[model samples]
Target: MNLNPEQITDYANTFIKVLIDYSPKLISAFIILFAGLYIIRLINRFIRRIMVKRNLDPTLTRFLADILLWVLRIILFVSFISKLGIETSSFVAILGAMGLAVGLSLQGSLSNFAGGMLIILFKPFRVSDTIEAQGVVGTVSEIQIFVTKLVTANNQTIFIPNGSLSNGNIINYSLEKIRRADLTIAISYDTNIKEAKDIITAVLKNNPKILETPAAEVSVKNLTDSAIQIAVRPWANNEDFWGVYADTLQNCKQAFDDAGIIIQPFFKESSKKNNPTEQLE
Candidate 1:
């Protein structure tokens, strides 16, 4: 309380000297940080525009953009923290310790994510394609990063994980312009093979939608206990599959009936009303 003037002057001078000493480092760090951050933001935006211009997959573009921004943020954050007198070694160590745990917990999900990326890149199938995968057959409606959705021929919706789709076999029937229709018809053993083949061939030949290139094949496929099975295959456009299928079937039946061919229903014999005891006796 007694030496007030000198003490006050000394304290003020000392404070000013300390600030001047560290001001250079502080200012340098601030300038470097601001410039680096601004450049990072600019680079991220530029990268996004380039990706879009290249017509890259929207999901992939977004993912890459996020990664770019995160990397820049990490660099800036470490530098800023160091300026504030905090060590980055301990921070990086903590991150390394936790990263493994997080990755393990999300292993399955991450695998599916990778699978999704491959699907988008390779494009084995797309929306509206009829595909058979994971033992389910349906028309694809949406293919997302995590899952793929399908609508069945009966109008049922099915969702499959991207991992399963990529890991398993997939059959894309809609990719082809023409699909071969396989039909099996059975007739009584007494029926003439020549007449039946001719009649079936004529039925398919009458339809213009059926392709003549493959040449509809009609051959006796099997000789069962009481009937002869005929194998018929015809090629037609994908859009006309169902229509051609029904028409070809109806025509074959009509042709067989006109030629006096009797189609023996397989199960009628075992369930025949005739008494077995009487026949045996």
Candidate 2:
């Protein structure tokens, strides 16, 4: 079908009319989009400065700023679409439903991320700090977004989910400058308790790693069927804890041997002797 002059003119007129009608909204949307992007940048920079001033962790700062930037941009995008006379309620609802689905599917990951954020913010433990948490005792090597890496004394690397780590009991041994080392020394019932205590006390005092300000003490902790338990309390710097502990045990054992005091390993053997069922196992 051939278009007449009137038909061509009418089509042109209709196109011009539509453009004229939507020109302001289109222009406004473009202006708002650019302006909103600039504003978001400024806001992100301002937030980063504030976080830095507050001494927040660098990782958390970047993560939070990125999240905020995206959230703000999403809102701005919705507003821009609304400015173009498009219905946004359905769009927002769809977005919300999609967000819910994603959140549900990544629930554990989100929880771990939140846990990591909390841990970084609160600093319950720091890198290189010896901490006991979730039944694992190790030095924290890295604190990631979803997990914390720990290096055990045996040089084993353990990855603990931040969710459980943040929620569980954390014993930070390196948080304090000083720590007390508790050792239970079991001696034969026939040995002299006072002499054993004196010898242990001397050993603790002689060790340079042990702190003298608290005055190390040795006392009777318990008495078993065949042995007397002595509790040796020694104070040392956090870094010297393991060293002092090992030295104390070695020195005490040597001292006991020299003093003719018997260190008994009778608890398990005595139990086995008393329980005939143990041998069967």
Please identify model 2 stretches exceeding 4 Å from their true place: 1-24, 120-122, 266-281
Please report, in order, the local distance difference test score of every candidate based on alpha carbons. Answer: 0.82, 0.87
Give each prediction's root-mean-square deviation over alpha carbons: 9.0, 5.8
lDDT of 2 by residue, 245-278 (tens): 7799899999988998888875765545443223
What shift in Å separates residue 143 of candidate 1 from its native position after superposition?
A: 1.7
* Model 1 agreement with the true structure over 140-250: per-residue lDDT tens digits: 888777788988767888889998889999998888989987767788878888988899989999999998987888998777787787888888899987678778878
Q: Which pairs, if any, clash in model 2? A: none
What's the distance in Å from true for residue 8, model 1?
17
The TM-score obtained by model 2 is: 0.79
